[model samples]
Target chain A: MSGEPANREPVDLAAKLASFGEHWSPRVVAGFNGHDVMVVKVQGEFVWHSHPETDDFFFVLKGRLTIRMREGDVTLLPGQLFVVPKGVEHCPVAEEETHLLLIEPAGTPNTGDPATAATKHAI
Target chain B: MSGEPANREPVDLAAKLASFGEHWSPRVVAGFNGHDVMVVKVQGEFVWHSHPETDDFFFVLKGRLTIRMREGDVTLLPGQLFVVPKGVEHCPVAEEETHLLLIEPAGTPNTGDPATAATKHAI
Candidate 1:
Protein backbone atom coordinates (compact mmCIF):
# COMPACT_ATOMS: atom_id res chain seq x y z
CA MET A 1 0.00 0.00 0.00
CA SER A 2 2.92 2.30 0.66
CA GLY A 3 5.11 2.76 -2.38
CA GLU A 4 4.71 5.75 -4.60
CA PRO A 5 4.29 9.19 -3.10
CA ALA A 6 0.85 9.48 -1.47
CA ASN A 7 -0.17 12.36 -3.67
CA ARG A 8 1.36 11.06 -6.85
CA GLU A 9 -1.45 8.80 -7.99
CA PRO A 10 -5.19 8.40 -8.02
CA VAL A 11 -6.98 6.02 -5.69
CA ASP A 12 -9.43 3.90 -7.60
CA LEU A 13 -12.44 3.22 -5.40
CA ALA A 14 -13.58 0.18 -7.35
CA ALA A 15 -10.11 -1.32 -7.27
CA LYS A 16 -9.74 -0.69 -3.59
CA LEU A 17 -13.12 -2.26 -2.82
CA ALA A 18 -12.14 -5.32 -4.81
CA SER A 19 -8.97 -5.82 -2.77
CA PHE A 20 -10.86 -7.03 0.30
CA GLY A 21 -14.04 -8.95 1.16
CA GLU A 22 -14.19 -9.17 4.97
CA HIS A 23 -17.37 -7.68 6.34
CA TRP A 24 -17.15 -4.79 8.82
CA SER A 25 -13.38 -4.67 8.58
CA PRO A 26 -12.54 -1.31 7.09
CA ARG A 27 -9.35 -0.85 5.10
CA VAL A 28 -7.75 2.54 4.95
CA VAL A 29 -7.24 3.54 1.36
CA ALA A 30 -6.12 7.12 1.71
CA GLY A 31 -5.75 10.00 4.13
CA PHE A 32 -6.13 13.75 3.92
CA ASN A 33 -6.38 16.73 6.26
CA GLY A 34 -6.34 14.66 9.47
CA HIS A 35 -8.98 12.25 8.18
CA ASP A 36 -8.84 8.67 6.92
CA VAL A 37 -10.57 7.56 3.78
CA MET A 38 -11.72 3.98 4.39
CA VAL A 39 -13.67 1.32 2.55
CA VAL A 40 -15.67 -1.41 4.27
CA LYS A 41 -18.03 -4.24 3.45
CA VAL A 42 -21.06 -5.03 5.58
CA GLN A 43 -23.91 -7.51 5.57
CA GLY A 44 -25.62 -7.19 8.95
CA GLU A 45 -26.31 -4.64 11.64
CA PHE A 46 -23.56 -2.72 13.35
CA VAL A 47 -23.47 -1.61 16.97
CA TRP A 48 -25.50 1.42 17.98
CA HIS A 49 -22.86 3.95 18.92
CA SER A 50 -21.99 7.62 18.75
CA HIS A 51 -18.78 9.46 18.14
CA PRO A 52 -18.80 12.06 20.87
CA GLU A 53 -16.13 14.16 19.16
CA THR A 54 -16.49 13.68 15.43
CA ASP A 55 -19.15 13.34 12.77
CA ASP A 56 -19.40 10.10 10.77
CA PHE A 57 -19.53 10.25 6.99
CA PHE A 58 -20.90 7.43 4.84
CA PHE A 59 -20.98 7.07 1.09
CA VAL A 60 -22.58 3.93 -0.31
CA LEU A 61 -20.60 2.32 -3.10
CA LYS A 62 -22.67 -0.82 -3.65
CA GLY A 63 -25.99 -2.26 -2.46
CA ARG A 64 -28.21 -0.57 0.13
CA LEU A 65 -27.27 0.88 3.51
CA THR A 66 -29.66 2.08 6.17
CA ILE A 67 -28.36 4.18 9.03
CA ARG A 68 -30.78 3.95 11.93
CA MET A 69 -30.85 6.79 14.39
CA ARG A 70 -33.02 7.80 17.30
CA GLU A 71 -34.67 10.45 15.17
CA GLY A 72 -35.21 8.40 12.02
CA ASP A 73 -33.60 6.14 9.46
CA VAL A 74 -31.66 7.30 6.42
CA THR A 75 -31.32 4.75 3.65
CA LEU A 76 -28.68 5.32 1.02
CA LEU A 77 -27.93 3.69 -2.30
CA PRO A 78 -25.03 4.03 -4.71
CA GLY A 79 -23.93 7.64 -5.28
CA GLN A 80 -25.58 8.86 -2.07
CA LEU A 81 -23.99 10.04 1.16
CA PHE A 82 -25.17 10.79 4.68
CA VAL A 83 -23.44 12.19 7.70
CA VAL A 84 -24.27 11.16 11.23
CA PRO A 85 -23.53 14.11 13.43
CA LYS A 86 -21.42 13.70 16.51
CA GLY A 87 -23.19 12.47 19.66
CA VAL A 88 -26.04 10.87 17.69
CA GLU A 89 -26.39 7.17 18.39
CA HIS A 90 -26.83 5.19 15.21
CA CYS A 91 -26.57 1.69 13.78
CA PRO A 92 -25.91 0.68 10.21
CA VAL A 93 -27.72 -2.26 8.64
CA ALA A 94 -27.53 -3.89 5.26
CA GLU A 95 -29.74 -6.80 4.25
CA GLU A 96 -27.37 -7.87 1.53
CA GLU A 97 -23.68 -7.33 0.95
CA THR A 98 -22.85 -3.67 0.85
CA HIS A 99 -19.77 -1.59 0.21
CA LEU A 100 -19.02 1.86 1.59
CA LEU A 101 -16.51 4.64 1.70
CA LEU A 102 -16.23 6.44 5.02
CA ILE A 103 -14.44 9.58 6.18
CA GLU A 104 -13.65 10.16 9.82
CA PRO A 105 -11.01 11.80 11.92
CA ALA A 106 -7.83 9.81 11.85
CA GLY A 107 -7.84 7.07 14.51
CA THR A 108 -11.56 7.42 15.28
CA PRO A 109 -12.88 4.06 16.42
CA ASN A 110 -15.58 2.31 14.44
CA THR A 111 -17.68 1.47 17.52
CA GLY A 112 -17.24 4.86 19.19
CA ASP A 113 -15.65 3.07 22.13
CA PRO A 114 -12.03 2.15 21.72
CA ALA A 115 -12.53 -1.05 23.69
CA THR A 116 -15.08 -2.44 21.24
CA ALA A 117 -13.96 -0.96 17.98
CA ALA A 118 -12.85 -3.14 15.13
CA THR A 119 -9.14 -3.06 14.32
CA LYS A 120 -8.51 -0.88 11.28
CA HIS A 121 -5.55 -1.48 9.03
CA ALA A 122 -4.25 -0.01 5.81
CA ILE A 123 -4.85 -2.00 2.62
CA MET B 1 -30.05 24.39 0.18
CA SER B 2 -30.75 24.47 3.87
CA GLY B 3 -33.91 22.53 4.58
CA GLU B 4 -34.44 19.46 6.72
CA PRO B 5 -31.86 18.77 9.39
CA ALA B 6 -28.41 18.62 7.81
CA ASN B 7 -27.74 15.09 8.94
CA ARG B 8 -31.30 13.84 8.60
CA GLU B 9 -31.24 13.08 4.91
CA PRO B 10 -28.92 11.76 2.23
CA VAL B 11 -27.20 13.95 -0.35
CA ASP B 12 -27.53 12.59 -3.85
CA LEU B 13 -24.40 13.38 -5.84
CA ALA B 14 -26.00 13.01 -9.24
CA ALA B 15 -28.97 15.15 -8.34
CA LYS B 16 -26.76 17.82 -6.85
CA LEU B 17 -24.53 17.89 -9.90
CA ALA B 18 -27.56 18.27 -12.12
CA SER B 19 -28.82 21.24 -10.13
CA PHE B 20 -25.93 23.41 -11.28
CA GLY B 21 -23.99 23.81 -14.51
CA GLU B 22 -21.43 26.52 -13.88
CA HIS B 23 -17.83 25.51 -14.51
CA TRP B 24 -15.36 25.75 -11.61
CA SER B 25 -18.00 27.09 -9.24
CA PRO B 26 -18.43 24.55 -6.45
CA ARG B 27 -21.69 24.33 -4.56
CA VAL B 28 -21.64 23.27 -0.95
CA VAL B 29 -23.87 20.24 -0.52
CA ALA B 30 -22.94 19.09 2.96
CA GLY B 31 -20.50 19.63 5.80
CA PHE B 32 -19.04 17.54 8.60
CA ASN B 33 -16.15 17.86 10.99
CA GLY B 34 -15.19 21.31 9.70
CA HIS B 35 -14.97 20.19 6.10
CA ASP B 36 -17.36 21.06 3.28
CA VAL B 37 -18.54 18.45 0.82
CA MET B 38 -18.84 20.28 -2.50
CA VAL B 39 -19.88 19.41 -6.00
CA VAL B 40 -18.77 21.30 -9.08
CA LYS B 41 -18.97 21.15 -12.85
CA VAL B 42 -15.63 21.81 -14.48
CA GLN B 43 -14.28 22.26 -18.01
CA GLY B 44 -11.01 23.62 -19.34
CA GLU B 45 -7.88 24.22 -17.31
CA PHE B 46 -7.88 25.75 -13.86
CA VAL B 47 -5.28 28.11 -12.47
CA TRP B 48 -2.19 26.44 -11.12
CA HIS B 49 -2.16 26.88 -7.38
CA SER B 50 -1.49 25.24 -4.05
CA HIS B 51 -3.29 25.22 -0.75
CA PRO B 52 -0.67 26.11 1.81
CA GLU B 53 -2.71 25.17 4.87
CA THR B 54 -4.61 22.05 3.84
CA ASP B 55 -4.77 19.18 1.42
CA ASP B 56 -7.28 19.21 -1.45
CA PHE B 57 -9.54 16.26 -2.31
CA PHE B 58 -11.12 15.49 -5.62
CA PHE B 59 -13.58 12.72 -6.55
CA VAL B 60 -14.71 12.41 -10.10
CA LEU B 61 -18.43 11.87 -10.54
CA LYS B 62 -18.78 12.12 -14.34
CA GLY B 63 -16.55 12.44 -17.40
CA ARG B 64 -12.79 12.70 -16.93
CA LEU B 65 -10.33 14.89 -15.03
CA THR B 66 -6.59 15.35 -15.20
CA ILE B 67 -4.70 16.82 -12.28
CA ARG B 68 -1.44 18.29 -13.47
CA MET B 69 1.36 18.69 -11.01
CA ARG B 70 5.03 19.48 -11.12
CA GLU B 71 6.00 15.85 -10.63
CA GLY B 72 3.56 14.37 -13.12
CA ASP B 73 -0.08 14.17 -14.18
CA VAL B 74 -2.76 12.01 -12.63
CA THR B 75 -5.87 11.41 -14.69
CA LEU B 76 -9.07 10.23 -13.03
CA LEU B 77 -12.40 8.90 -14.17
CA PRO B 78 -15.74 8.18 -12.52
CA GLY B 79 -15.49 6.65 -9.03
CA GLN B 80 -11.87 7.69 -8.69
CA LEU B 81 -10.17 10.14 -6.34
CA PHE B 82 -6.89 11.91 -5.85
CA VAL B 83 -5.53 14.06 -3.07
CA VAL B 84 -3.18 16.92 -3.70
CA PRO B 85 -1.09 17.24 -0.58
CA LYS B 86 -0.76 20.56 1.13
CA GLY B 87 1.79 22.92 -0.42
CA VAL B 88 1.89 20.96 -3.64
CA GLU B 89 1.14 23.01 -6.73
CA HIS B 90 -1.47 21.46 -8.99
CA CYS B 91 -3.90 22.35 -11.73
CA PRO B 92 -7.05 20.47 -12.75
CA VAL B 93 -8.08 20.17 -16.37
CA ALA B 94 -11.02 18.54 -18.11
CA GLU B 95 -11.30 18.48 -21.86
CA GLU B 96 -15.02 17.78 -21.79
CA GLU B 97 -17.63 18.74 -19.22
CA THR B 98 -16.85 17.04 -15.91
CA HIS B 99 -18.52 16.68 -12.56
CA LEU B 100 -16.64 16.40 -9.26
CA LEU B 101 -17.14 16.00 -5.55
CA LEU B 102 -14.57 17.76 -3.41
CA ILE B 103 -13.64 17.83 0.25
CA GLU B 104 -11.69 20.67 1.81
CA PRO B 105 -11.50 22.56 5.06
CA ALA B 106 -14.37 24.95 5.60
CA GLY B 107 -13.63 28.42 4.13
CA THR B 108 -10.62 27.29 2.10
CA PRO B 109 -10.39 29.26 -1.11
CA ASN B 110 -10.77 27.43 -4.41
CA THR B 111 -7.97 29.33 -6.13
CA GLY B 112 -5.58 29.10 -3.16
CA ASP B 113 -5.54 32.91 -3.03
CA PRO B 114 -8.57 34.49 -1.39
CA ALA B 115 -8.38 37.57 -3.55
CA THR B 116 -9.05 35.62 -6.74
CA ALA B 117 -10.88 32.54 -5.52
CA ALA B 118 -14.40 31.86 -6.67
CA THR B 119 -17.06 32.87 -4.19
CA LYS B 120 -18.31 29.51 -2.92
CA HIS B 121 -21.96 29.39 -1.98
CA ALA B 122 -24.27 26.67 -0.75
CA ILE B 123 -26.60 25.15 -3.30
Candidate 2:
Protein backbone atom coordinates (compact mmCIF):
# COMPACT_ATOMS: atom_id res chain seq x y z
CA MET A 1 0.00 0.00 0.00
CA SER A 2 2.41 2.61 -1.26
CA GLY A 3 0.64 4.16 -4.23
CA GLU A 4 -1.49 7.15 -5.14
CA PRO A 5 -5.16 7.16 -4.25
CA ALA A 6 -6.47 9.92 -6.48
CA ASN A 7 -8.83 7.57 -8.27
CA ARG A 8 -10.22 5.19 -5.72
CA GLU A 9 -12.03 2.01 -6.74
CA PRO A 10 -13.29 -0.14 -3.91
CA VAL A 11 -13.36 -3.83 -4.70
CA ASP A 12 -15.96 -6.27 -3.42
CA LEU A 13 -14.19 -9.59 -2.95
CA ALA A 14 -17.40 -11.59 -3.14
CA ALA A 15 -18.55 -9.96 -6.35
CA LYS A 16 -15.14 -10.27 -7.98
CA LEU A 17 -14.91 -13.96 -7.16
CA ALA A 18 -18.37 -14.47 -8.60
CA SER A 19 -17.46 -12.96 -11.97
CA PHE A 20 -14.51 -15.30 -12.52
CA GLY A 21 -15.07 -18.90 -13.54
CA GLU A 22 -11.71 -20.51 -14.03
CA HIS A 23 -9.30 -22.53 -11.91
CA TRP A 24 -5.59 -21.70 -11.61
CA SER A 25 -6.16 -18.33 -13.26
CA PRO A 26 -5.88 -15.24 -11.11
CA ARG A 27 -8.00 -12.13 -11.54
CA VAL A 28 -6.48 -8.91 -10.35
CA VAL A 29 -8.70 -7.19 -7.83
CA ALA A 30 -6.55 -4.31 -6.68
CA GLY A 31 -3.01 -2.93 -6.58
CA PHE A 32 -0.79 -1.06 -4.16
CA ASN A 33 2.67 0.12 -4.91
CA GLY A 34 4.20 -2.59 -7.12
CA HIS A 35 2.10 -5.44 -5.75
CA ASP A 36 -1.18 -6.84 -7.04
CA VAL A 37 -3.90 -8.44 -5.00
CA MET A 38 -5.35 -11.36 -6.93
CA VAL A 39 -7.98 -14.00 -6.46
CA VAL A 40 -7.86 -17.43 -8.05
CA LYS A 41 -9.95 -20.56 -7.89
CA VAL A 42 -7.73 -23.60 -7.80
CA GLN A 43 -8.36 -27.32 -7.89
CA GLY A 44 -6.28 -30.47 -8.40
CA GLU A 45 -2.69 -29.25 -8.61
CA PHE A 46 -0.50 -26.59 -10.13
CA VAL A 47 2.98 -27.16 -11.48
CA TRP A 48 6.01 -26.72 -9.24
CA HIS A 49 7.66 -23.35 -9.63
CA SER A 50 9.16 -20.34 -7.91
CA HIS A 51 9.30 -16.61 -8.45
CA PRO A 52 12.99 -15.91 -8.63
CA GLU A 53 12.49 -12.22 -8.03
CA THR A 54 9.61 -11.95 -5.57
CA ASP A 55 7.83 -13.75 -2.76
CA ASP A 56 4.32 -15.27 -2.97
CA PHE A 57 1.59 -14.59 -0.44
CA PHE A 58 -1.27 -17.04 -0.14
CA PHE A 59 -4.38 -16.61 2.00
CA VAL A 60 -7.00 -19.28 1.86
CA LEU A 61 -10.51 -17.97 1.41
CA LYS A 62 -12.49 -21.20 0.94
CA GLY A 63 -11.69 -24.88 1.43
CA ARG A 64 -8.09 -25.90 1.92
CA LEU A 65 -4.75 -25.58 0.09
CA THR A 66 -1.62 -27.67 0.41
CA ILE A 67 1.64 -26.10 -0.69
CA ARG A 68 4.28 -28.72 -1.35
CA MET A 69 7.92 -27.84 -0.97
CA ARG A 70 11.12 -29.82 -0.87
CA GLU A 71 11.46 -29.24 2.86
CA GLY A 72 7.86 -29.96 3.76
CA ASP A 73 4.22 -29.24 2.94
CA VAL A 74 2.15 -26.34 4.22
CA THR A 75 -1.57 -26.77 4.75
CA LEU A 76 -3.67 -23.66 4.84
CA LEU A 77 -7.31 -23.47 5.85
CA PRO A 78 -9.53 -20.42 5.72
CA GLY A 79 -7.99 -17.57 7.71
CA GLN A 80 -4.48 -18.97 7.33
CA LEU A 81 -1.51 -17.71 5.33
CA PHE A 82 1.82 -19.02 4.10
CA VAL A 83 4.51 -17.05 2.30
CA VAL A 84 6.84 -18.94 0.04
CA PRO A 85 10.17 -17.17 -0.32
CA LYS A 86 11.55 -16.28 -3.71
CA GLY A 87 13.38 -19.01 -5.63
CA VAL A 88 11.89 -21.75 -3.51
CA GLU A 89 10.51 -24.56 -5.63
CA HIS A 90 6.96 -25.32 -4.64
CA CYS A 91 3.69 -26.70 -5.97
CA PRO A 92 0.19 -25.79 -4.86
CA VAL A 93 -2.41 -28.55 -4.65
CA ALA A 94 -5.96 -28.60 -3.43
CA GLU A 95 -8.07 -31.59 -2.55
CA GLU A 96 -11.15 -29.71 -3.67
CA GLU A 97 -11.97 -26.39 -5.30
CA THR A 98 -10.32 -23.67 -3.19
CA HIS A 99 -10.47 -19.92 -3.42
CA LEU A 100 -7.28 -18.01 -2.62
CA LEU A 101 -6.15 -14.44 -2.29
CA LEU A 102 -2.61 -13.90 -3.52
CA ILE A 103 -0.43 -10.85 -3.00
CA GLU A 104 2.66 -10.56 -5.14
CA PRO A 105 4.51 -8.38 -7.60
CA ALA A 106 2.30 -7.14 -10.46
CA GLY A 107 3.82 -9.24 -13.27
CA THR A 108 4.40 -12.47 -11.31
CA PRO A 109 3.05 -15.61 -12.97
CA ASN A 110 1.47 -18.62 -11.30
CA THR A 111 4.28 -20.82 -12.51
CA GLY A 112 7.02 -18.25 -11.79
CA ASP A 113 8.67 -18.54 -15.20
CA PRO A 114 7.33 -16.25 -17.91
CA ALA A 115 7.65 -18.88 -20.65
CA THR A 116 5.69 -21.50 -18.74
CA ALA A 117 2.11 -22.40 -19.71
CA ALA A 118 0.88 -20.77 -16.48
CA THR A 119 2.53 -17.50 -17.31
CA LYS A 120 0.77 -14.17 -17.86
CA HIS A 121 -2.71 -14.47 -19.32
CA ALA A 122 -6.14 -12.82 -19.18
CA ILE A 123 -6.81 -11.02 -15.90
CA MET B 1 5.13 -10.00 -1.25
CA SER B 2 8.55 -8.80 -2.33
CA GLY B 3 10.60 -10.13 0.58
CA GLU B 4 12.83 -13.14 0.88
CA PRO B 5 11.03 -16.12 2.40
CA ALA B 6 14.04 -17.79 3.96
CA ASN B 7 13.52 -19.23 7.45
CA ARG B 8 9.83 -19.20 6.76
CA GLU B 9 7.47 -19.13 9.69
CA PRO B 10 3.89 -19.47 8.57
CA VAL B 11 1.09 -17.80 10.50
CA ASP B 12 -2.33 -18.98 11.55
CA LEU B 13 -4.53 -15.94 11.13
CA ALA B 14 -7.27 -17.33 13.35
CA ALA B 15 -4.89 -18.23 16.14
CA LYS B 16 -3.05 -14.93 16.06
CA LEU B 17 -6.31 -13.02 16.20
CA ALA B 18 -7.32 -15.05 19.21
CA SER B 19 -4.05 -14.41 21.05
CA PHE B 20 -4.48 -10.68 20.91
CA GLY B 21 -6.67 -8.90 23.45
CA GLU B 22 -6.51 -5.19 22.78
CA HIS B 23 -8.40 -2.88 20.46
CA TRP B 24 -6.85 -0.22 18.23
CA SER B 25 -3.42 -1.70 19.00
CA PRO B 26 -1.84 -3.96 16.38
CA ARG B 27 0.05 -7.18 17.02
CA VAL B 28 2.68 -8.12 14.51
CA VAL B 29 2.15 -11.63 13.23
CA ALA B 30 4.57 -11.79 10.32
CA GLY B 31 7.25 -9.76 8.65
CA PHE B 32 8.33 -9.63 5.01
CA ASN B 33 10.91 -7.34 3.53
CA GLY B 34 10.49 -4.11 5.46
CA HIS B 35 6.77 -4.65 6.03
CA ASP B 36 4.79 -6.33 8.77
CA VAL B 37 1.57 -8.30 8.68
CA MET B 38 -0.56 -7.54 11.72
CA VAL B 39 -3.84 -8.63 13.25
CA VAL B 40 -5.77 -6.39 15.58
CA LYS B 41 -9.13 -6.54 17.27
CA VAL B 42 -10.61 -3.13 16.63
CA GLN B 43 -13.70 -1.53 18.14
CA GLY B 44 -14.96 2.04 18.37
CA GLU B 45 -13.06 4.64 16.35
CA PHE B 46 -9.36 5.32 15.73
CA VAL B 47 -7.53 8.61 15.41
CA TRP B 48 -7.31 10.43 12.10
CA HIS B 49 -3.82 10.66 10.66
CA SER B 50 -1.72 9.93 7.61
CA HIS B 51 1.38 7.87 6.99
CA PRO B 52 3.52 10.11 4.86
CA GLU B 53 5.87 7.41 3.64
CA THR B 54 3.88 4.23 3.20
CA ASP B 55 0.32 3.23 2.34
CA ASP B 56 -1.85 0.99 4.51
CA PHE B 57 -3.58 -2.27 3.60
CA PHE B 58 -6.73 -3.30 5.46
CA PHE B 59 -8.47 -6.63 5.14
CA VAL B 60 -11.50 -7.23 7.29
CA LEU B 61 -11.76 -10.69 8.78
CA LYS B 62 -14.87 -10.42 10.95
CA GLY B 63 -17.67 -7.88 11.45
CA ARG B 64 -17.37 -4.67 9.43
CA LEU B 65 -14.98 -1.72 9.11
CA THR B 66 -15.59 1.78 7.86
CA ILE B 67 -12.50 3.69 6.82
CA ARG B 68 -13.34 7.37 6.99
CA MET B 69 -11.45 9.71 4.76
CA ARG B 70 -11.92 13.29 3.55
CA GLU B 71 -13.41 12.27 0.22
CA GLY B 72 -15.61 9.37 1.34
CA ASP B 73 -15.86 6.37 3.61
CA VAL B 74 -15.01 2.89 2.44
CA THR B 75 -16.92 -0.02 3.93
CA LEU B 76 -15.23 -3.42 4.09
CA LEU B 77 -16.83 -6.70 4.98
CA PRO B 78 -15.22 -10.07 5.50
CA GLY B 79 -12.96 -11.11 2.64
CA GLN B 80 -12.95 -7.52 1.36
CA LEU B 81 -9.93 -5.19 1.32
CA PHE B 82 -9.05 -1.53 0.85
CA VAL B 83 -5.76 0.31 0.54
CA VAL B 84 -5.35 3.85 1.80
CA PRO B 85 -2.61 5.53 -0.14
CA LYS B 86 0.29 7.22 1.56
CA GLY B 87 -0.30 10.77 2.83
CA VAL B 88 -4.09 10.31 2.79
CA GLU B 89 -5.66 11.20 6.14
CA HIS B 90 -7.93 8.43 7.32
CA CYS B 91 -9.66 7.08 10.41
CA PRO B 92 -10.88 3.55 11.06
CA VAL B 93 -14.21 2.98 12.76
CA ALA B 94 -15.95 -0.20 13.70
CA GLU B 95 -19.56 -0.57 14.81
CA GLU B 96 -18.77 -3.61 16.88
CA GLU B 97 -15.80 -5.80 17.66
CA THR B 98 -14.07 -6.39 14.35
CA HIS B 99 -11.04 -8.43 13.45
CA LEU B 100 -8.63 -7.10 10.84
CA LEU B 101 -5.45 -8.09 9.04
CA LEU B 102 -3.23 -5.11 8.33
CA ILE B 103 -0.26 -4.98 5.95
CA GLU B 104 2.09 -2.03 6.33
CA PRO B 105 5.71 -1.08 6.59
CA ALA B 106 7.46 -2.47 9.64
CA GLY B 107 7.62 -0.20 12.75
CA THR B 108 4.66 1.79 11.42
CA PRO B 109 2.69 3.25 14.28
CA ASN B 110 -1.06 2.93 14.33
CA THR B 111 -1.29 6.68 14.73
CA GLY B 112 1.11 7.33 11.87
CA ASP B 113 3.16 9.35 14.33
CA PRO B 114 5.92 7.83 16.43
CA ALA B 115 5.09 9.90 19.51
CA THR B 116 1.43 8.95 19.62
CA ALA B 117 0.12 6.57 22.30
CA ALA B 118 -0.68 4.01 19.59
CA THR B 119 2.94 3.83 18.52
CA LYS B 120 5.06 0.64 18.58
CA HIS B 121 4.14 -1.85 21.26
CA ALA B 122 4.87 -5.44 22.23
CA ILE B 123 3.34 -8.18 20.14
For model 1, residues B34-103, the per-residue Cα lDDT tens digits are: 9999999999999999888888899998999999988789999998998888888889999999999999
* Model 1 alpha-carbon drift over 4 Å, by segment: A1-6, B1-6
Show the colliding residue pairs in model 2. none
Error in Å for residue A82 of model 2? 0.7
| Per-model C-alpha RMSD | 3.7, 3.1
Which candidate ranks first by lDDT, i.e. highest? 1
TM-score of each: 0.95, 0.89
Question: Cα deviation of A102 in candidate 2 (Å)?
Answer: 0.2
